[model samples]
Target: MDVQQPLALLGGLSPAQFMRRHWHKKPLLVRQAIPGFKPTVGRAALFELAGREEVESRFIQHKEGQWLLRHGPLARRSLPSLTTPEWTVLVQGVDLHDDATHALMQQFRFVPEARLDDLMISFASDGGGVGPHFDSYDVFLLQAHGKRRWRIGRQKNLALREGLPLKILASFEPEEEYVLEPGDMLYLPPRWAHDGIAEGACMTYSIGFRSPNRAGLAHEVLLRLADAAVDEEASPIYRDPGQQAVAGPGAIPAELQDFARQAVQHALQQPLALECALGEALTEPKPNVWFEPAEAAGMLESVVLDRRTCMMYDDQHVFINGESYLASGPDAALMRRLADERRLMPGDLAKASDDALELLSSWCESGWAHAGLSG
Candidate 1:
């Protein structure tokens, strides 16, 4: 992927240009972003995916001046009448299930993998919408089918309506409007208020980015760092002076506070601890995701990794599905290539040494990856 090369996906701008000119700064509407774009999964198939426990889904119905929202595992019977307009079913993380959707998501890889979240597909009837709201992360809204009317603006007032089930903006002000047909896409940065209402039967694909809040990030990273520190067998006990006299039982010892702070600092001081934690955090499977254990048939000279797998690497380590492995030499190079390409060709697999092959075999057995004959 050449960051400087112009791409139709980025509205004829190179990724470098897009990043510099618009990313997290303004909005871009790309006409015919995906020429001849169509839904990869049919309505029934999408509904079936929504019924699965691992897929996050929701249904929204707006009718007779009333709005209703429901979480899914929804049976088709539970859905609003398709014959009537103003109903919708949204399935999140379509990229994790469909190969085509995953391929579509790769076009945005110029952004950091950590920020690249998942694709969500919304199937809506006439007038269906989730209401006006703002997202904390950037998003690319691609119209897949039918038509949708979008009104957008830079929102200054962040006030929300109280007592509503949804966090809808209390007062939405629109400065721009566009009616999108198939293949039209709108890119909006974080906090840009927008609302999309279906003009008729419609399907919209949202490529949403992740924006981890600071406190939430710290909590996850600290937990991971603590686990790694414990694994290192470095549990040092706190010591107190025997001769020290306490005026009150409620008085906290200053030395103990300093010791606790030093402990936290020490854990964070480990080389690349933050990087490792970040990789693990990004690859952590959603609650709905689960993997079946791969059956071990026999030792293989080579194998192909699973498409659902998220593999990434940095200078010192390789991360796959929240687990990190030390990276070095030819094996490291091969693993890094696999992460980038999302597949190991026969030629690449042939370069793997016995040690690397053994590790890959273990991964296959654990269902983190899959095995295949050289093609």
Candidate 2:
């Protein structure tokens, strides 16, 4: 996308302007962010998706001054009637299940793919809400159907109500409020408290971004680094033949501690090892995601990545579905384009070397990609 070009989605601000002025700094309320926007997944379809074993979903209800939350495979019969008040059904990762929903996510590609997370759709009855809460990551709340009244504030006190299943703010203080119709969108920075109550039956789409905390990120990276070190052909083993016996056998040896430190440093010293591991970890599929294997086809004309496939690239490697491949020169350029565009045309494929073709064919066979132009 041209960063300088203005977008209706960002309320007439160019991608560059939006990133500079509002991203992680303040809120943006865009009227008609998507003109004439309609729900990508209808009510019935959403409920059906929630019932699928592979999908992550939740059911919440606040009735008679009591709050209830339930994990789903929520059957249609299990849901409250449309007339029921103060109830909601939330379906996570709608993009992974529906083509149109996935296409809708493409609008937000101005952000780096690495930071972009999944889209969630929530359906609610009259007065329904999950309660006022703050998210650790940024979110774009777009109204897709009916109307929702939103109360938002820059929360200072982050305390949550005790003994509740949800992390609802104990003392919610609203600074602004709005009633959003279809096509309206509100962007909130991380830690901004917000609550939305349905005026009637409504559907809302949330586009969220990944914001990994330091400890969680370190945990993932360290595990990948250890795995990479183990896969090496010859890793140095700890040697202490010259060490003297210690009187305190319960305590770990100082020499052993030094060896452990060196081992981690050695892993970090490998050529592009940290970059490869980070890329692979970022592109790894979620736990519930699974692909249907496809038969290898001869003479590929075009190829598109599977919707569930997560692909990314760095200077030295291309990462997909938790695996990494060394890439450079023309082949690397082509792979990078595939990663960016998520598809390659016949003309693009014609430029691929024999090895590249073979690799793409393997991806297709593994169901990570398909042999057809993306619609």
Candidate 3:
């Protein structure tokens, strides 16, 4: 996308302008972000997805001053009556299951793919809401159906109510409010408290970004680095030919500690090792995601990545579904395009080398990508 091109989705701001002015800095409320928007997944379809064991879903109800929460797969029979006020069903990762929902999410690709997370759809009855709460990551809440009254504030008191299944704010202070109709959207940065209550029966689509914590990122990258190093030639074992016996055998030896440190440093020292590991980890499929096998695609006219497939690239490598491949020159450029656009046209595919074509064919066979143009 052209960064300088203004978009209705960003409320007439160019992507560059929006990112500079609002991202991680303040809230942005865009009226008619998607003109004439309708719910891509209907109520019945959403409930069907919630019933699937592979999908992550939650059922919440606030009734008579009592709150109830339940995890799914929640069968339709288990749900409250449609007339029941203050009841909600949240289905996570809707993009992974529906084509139109995935296409809706692609509009937000102005942000880097690494930070772009999944889209979640929440279906609710009259006056329903998940309560006032703040997210650790940024979110774009888009109204899909009916109307929702949203109260937002810059929360200073981050304390949560006790003995609750949800982390609801104990003191929710509202500074501004709006009633959103279909196609309206509100963007909130991390830690900005907000509450949305349904005016009637409604559905909201939440586009969330991933904010990987430092410790968690380190844990995953380090583990991948270790796994990558396992196939390499072995490093030397610790030796103490010149050392004297220690007074306490229970204590870790200083030489052995140095040896362990050196081993880690050696692993990190490999060229592009850190980058490869980080890329692979970021592209890794979520635990609940699975792909269907496909027949081998011998000749590719065009190809599109599976919606569930996560693909990314660096200067030196292309990463897809937790695996990495060395990439360079024109081939690398082509792969980068594929990652950015999630599809390759026939004209683009004609430039691929035999090796790249073979690799793409193998990906098609594995269901990571499709053999033809996606509709």
Candidate 4:
């Protein structure tokens, strides 16, 4: 994508301009983000995805002014009739299941792939909605079919209604409203509360970004670091030779606390250990994602990483699907290109070191990559 060139998706603003002006700062309502947009996945196809065991989905219904929610692996028969009013079926990660959906997501690669999460589709009958709620991450809500009336606010009161499966705003104070038609889009920042209700039967595509909370992200990184540390060193267990009587057995000892801190410090101290752990954590595949191993190696004239595979690299390491490898020299450059472009030509691989070529082959064998013309 040329940052200098204006985009129809961002209402004639360049990706750089959109990122600088509206990203994470305010809302943007593009009149026709995708002109004459049609859903890549139809209603029937979305229902099929909701039925798949590996896909994440949800069913919500609002009847007689009451809100209800359900988890899915829902069958077509289980879903409410198309004529049913005030019901919705939402499927998460549609990009993972459909090629067209995946391609649609790629258009938004102006955002770093690490932050770019999944593309979800929400289908609704008349007046259907999940209720007024705020997300912890940024999102682009693109209307695909029919129309949706959206009520949004910069919610100051984040309290939720108690005793509900869904985290609905107890006191929703909508500051703005709009009726979005097909091809229209709304961009929202984290914690900008919004509620979208179907004017009639409608489909909306949500392009969401992951904003990992500081503490939760720190915990995951530390766990990965600890795993790497264990493989690198066999530290001795603490032995209390001069035992001191404890006043309370329930209390954690100061010595044990220090040992825990030291353990984390040691992991952080290792050269590139923190970087390795972070890259691995960011590139880790979703728990439900699984790939079948390749039966035999094929031609390697060109190669592309599988859509389900996650690949990323830093200055010293390349990470793919939760594993990390040290890379340097020309091999490092080659691997970085693979990570960026997600495809490598025959000539590109010809310049790779023996170690890098072997690694790419192994990735193919593991079903993380395939040898052929990339889509």
lDDT of each: 0.86, 0.93, 0.95, 0.90
Candidate 4's error at 64, in angstroms? Answer: 1.3
Report the C-alpha lDDT of model 2 over 201-234, residue by residue, as the tens digit: 9999999999998888888888999987888887
TM-score of 4: 0.94
**Candidate 1 lDDT tens digits, 1-375:** 789999888789999999999999999999998899888777788889888877889988766866777898778877877668888899999988987888888888899777888899999988889889999999999999999999999999999988766778999999999999999999999999999999988899999998999999999899999888888875888988553776787877888899999989998888899999988877887776667787773656456556567788889899988898888999999998878877776688779998887888788887777777432
Better of 1 and 4 by lDDT: 4
Candidate 2: clashing residue pairs, number: 0
lDDT of candidate model 2 versus the reference:
0.93
TM-scores of the candidates in the order shown: 0.94, 0.97, 0.98, 0.94
Decoy 1 TM-score against native: 0.94
User: Which regions of candidate 2 fall more than 4 Å away from where they truly are?
Assistant: 373-375
User: Least accurate stretch of 10 residues (summed lDDT) in model 1?
Assistant: 297-306
**Against the true structure, what is every candidate's RMSD?**
1.9, 1.7, 1.7, 2.2
lDDT value, candidate 1, whole model: 0.86
Ranking by lDDT: 3, 2, 4, 1
- Of 1 and 3, the candidate ranking higher by TM-score: 3
Flag regions of model 3 displaced more than 4 Å. Answer: 373-375
Among these predictions, the greatest lDDT belongs to 3
lDDT of 4 by residue, 1-375 (tens): 688789999999999999999999999999999999999999999999999999999999988877788898989899888889999999999997887898899889898888999999999999899999999999999999999999999999999999887899999999999999999999999999999999989999999999998998999899998777778757868767766898888898788888888887887998888888899899999988988788556546778888888888999998999999988899999998898778899899879877777788889889999876333
lDDT of 3 by residue, 243-362 (tens): 887798899888889988988899899999899999999999999999998997767899999999999999999999999999999899999999999999999999999999999989
TM-score of 2: 0.97
